[model samples]
Target: MTASDDPVLTEVTGRTGRLTLNRPRALNALTHPMVRRIAETLDAWEHDPAVRTVVLTGAGARGLCAGGDIRAVHDDIRAGGGAASAAFWRDEYRLNARIARYPKPYVAFMDGIVMGGGVGVSAHGTVRIVTERTRLAMPETGIGFVPDVGGTHLLALAPGELGTYLALTGQPVGAGDALRCGLADHFVPAGRLPDLLTALAGRDVHDVLADFVGEAPPGRLDAHRAWIDHAFAADTVEEIVDRLLGSGRPAAQEAAAALLAASPTSLKVTLAALRGAPGLGPLEAVLEQEYRVSCAALSAPDLAEGIRAQVIDKDRTPRWSPASLAEVTDDDVARFFAPPAGRPLRLATGAAPQEVPW
Candidate 1:
């Protein structure tokens, strides 16, 4: 797509390569074209001596990004079957890996509702900045999906069972909680974002960031860390639910309610994915596994059901196939990890010789 038509706005300002998620109307929800554009721009900027750093942000005030265009994915699933949806995940995950491994100073101005695909793009960068308005989450499970975009890798690295708690509950967190969870590196006020970008033109990015960094307000996650660990420490989801129910604490009760409301298959697969993530060799491995789950999920109908209930019909009630946690067996979860019948995601291990196609 041309610059005017593109959802992502890319430009070079002095020594910095800047990208703005331009789809403000859609809350900067990423499409395949947008993802490819970002990957290509980053690739081009990586080798350019003139570009010392990269700055990413979203347009308008809603926040950096909401996530991928799930409505579009829903349409793709309905019309073109799984091919289009699979292709999007494959490309999107590849871009996520690229961001995580980018060598230069990559700064993300995560000031709004950063979730799912937003987290995929920004959280993996070298310097992740969250503002007071920042609300972040890896909330794919709510949509009958496991958190992809190397989310499992980041979740695995979170303190103790917090990753399990966040992944299963799909809870949105603020700047302080984001920092406490290792989701963000610094907290900058939303009003100062323009100054941060302006400073990036001539000054060192670190100096600019340090100058603009503000103390984040207190977060509740640390206070409940013990409860979170105790409730989510179980080897299985059922056990975790049992623990939560037995805890009698308000936080445990809330978490249990959230988990119970999520898709059964998504909960099972997400639990297994996060549990097995630490042992996975690399980010690419996690992406590969997630790709398998996403592709397999296309056939399960929960994805479509989720979109219908949550986004399309606005019913707020999803009729999951397994229906209950007991119905989601080991075999059901295992199938999600199996290799796709078509092609597996082949992530770039090093610098690429050719531009990644859309």
Candidate 2:
């Protein structure tokens, strides 16, 4: 798709419908409009017999998607809370659920910086492709936000304590670690993505798999695995942070520093959400918890401050409310899981997991 028309492009290639994120300059950070268009196109193609499969990727080599348009979401929160912005999240989460349960073979080339909202679009696909350039994360805590777009669900599904570690610390995992954690299916080199996509356009999943000709890069996270597994094994975010701080390992120390820099309240609530999420009744239940948390995040002092410092001001120093994790009470975290006055998440029923397209 050309940049002139839409940031997201939809094209039919044989029986495959390709959705390309087309904002290279911004690393294809998803705007609300982009999400809407993608959802609309997917809805159209879902039941269209003409389209047998769907492939989602980005336009440039730099990244697949950096995440949501946090600036827009931040602006909405600043304006005021009402139906308009609330509806955007509702629709976005619904799209996420639909993608998770999409009937056709859905393939996501999770090339780079597939964090936050980007994870929503690509992680739930039948096939998740990782490349050497892929830098996958769920870094909402850093910005006073809980991981949304059904990220909690995926995090819950990740191996061992890695999900909690990621939620609390916002650490980036490379392709090998992503594969180890079940976030990605196959590792392919960046240079070969086009030819693979070209081959995938006219063929079946089996054919596409057969055509793949790339080797996995050397794993980067192996040395830190022991620390990651142990430190994040703590029951709470505070405990995890404390353990990391005391570990004395350089990586652990750096990670602790990063966590300390994030909004304390964000860390508290995100940890609670990730731990509680796995037992939630369904994806919608988890999303409802996330929605409540997200709305509450707007009201909290840190969100706007984080956005101002990080995006608007570009100052890189947010003065977070409840400046330390110890100051954030459990009650504060609990409020986010509670439902709003009347509206609740309207989730779809009858979702069943399908075979992962190899």
Candidate 3:
């Protein structure tokens, strides 16, 4: 591919090694090759004494990344049982884990529409910066998939039931909410980012951030926490919906509607994933579990159908197989927890967290 065609653009400026996701037309959505490229670059940069920091951003004005190229994944699923898609996720999740524990600073420009795989890449980094334009989400359920890319680990770590709330609804949150949820570290103005980028190329992040970090305007989630913590705290998705519907608040009712609109099986499985994530140990263990869940989802009917309805067909109506939360039985959700038939993603492998010297 030519320069314009390269999905991931890499360059070095002063002490910063930069990665720019280049698919502007597709909102810089990631492909398997793009995932591999990012992993390869990080591996090279970690040992390069000249590269003091690594920065990731997108080339487009639309977003940092919309997500992994799910349309490609959807097509792969339809063609041959999602073997390629599974392989893509293995590497993607590995990169997510690597980002989380990188020896050197990993700064992500979490500006504009960042979702799904977008969250995987940026949210895991050491220095995650969000601007007013940031629209961040883990919208896996809407596509009949569970949160992968170590998403459950990040969301599960969110205060109270905020993670459960975000994972179930797949709603986008702004800079304030992202910071509140521990998904991002700093908020900077969009206009100021150009100058900030200039300073970051050669200067220390702490000194550079001291000049640019400022208050994020208020977000809506903090206001609704009382009800969210209570309603989503329920043990089951059924009870969660019933509590929301019965809560008698408009936002709660709207959340109920959002949950009702998603694939029934996805909602159930997502709840199980969220509930199970807390005990799954480090990000790596949670990622390994997410891999099993994601691979299981590949063979399920809704993965492809959800993508077709929401993306390809643009009909906004997916006819989910289970049809309702009530129809998704315990066994159906349990199937996702079972060990995958293929090779598993085994990061960290039950080892204690390492203290990286960087």
Q: Please, what are the lDDT tens digits per residue for candidate 2 over residues 230-323?
A: 9888887778878898888998999898888888988888888888898986777777777787767766788777888889889998898888
Q: Compare the candidates by lDDT and give the number of the best one.
A: 3
Clashes of each: 1, 0, 0
Local accuracy of candidate 3 as per-residue lDDT tens digits, 1-358: 6987788989899989999999999999999999999989998998899998999999878889999998998999999899999999888988888888888888999999999999999998889999999999988888898888889888999999999999999999999999999999999998888888899887978778989999998989989999999999999999999999998999999999999999889989888888888897888889888989999999999999999999999999999998888889899999999999987777763222222323
TM-score winner, 2 or 3: 3
Candidate 3, lDDT over the whole model: 0.90
Where model 2 places Cα greater than 4 Å from the true spot, the runs are 1-3, 351-358
Tens-digit lDDT track for model 1 on 1-358? 6776569898988888999999999899999999999989998998999998999999888989999999988888898886888998888888888888888889999998999999999998999999899999988888898888888889889988888899999999999999988989999889898988989988778777778999998887988888899888888889889999888898889899998999999999999999898897778778888889889988877898898889998999999888999999999999999888887765545543222344
Better of 1 and 2 by TM-score: 1
List the lowest-lDDT window of 10 residues for candidate 1. Answer: 349-358
What ranking of all candidate models by lDDT puts the best one first? 3, 1, 2
Stretches of candidate 1 off by over 4 Å are: 1-5, 351-358
Model 2 Cα RMSD, 1 decimal? 4.0
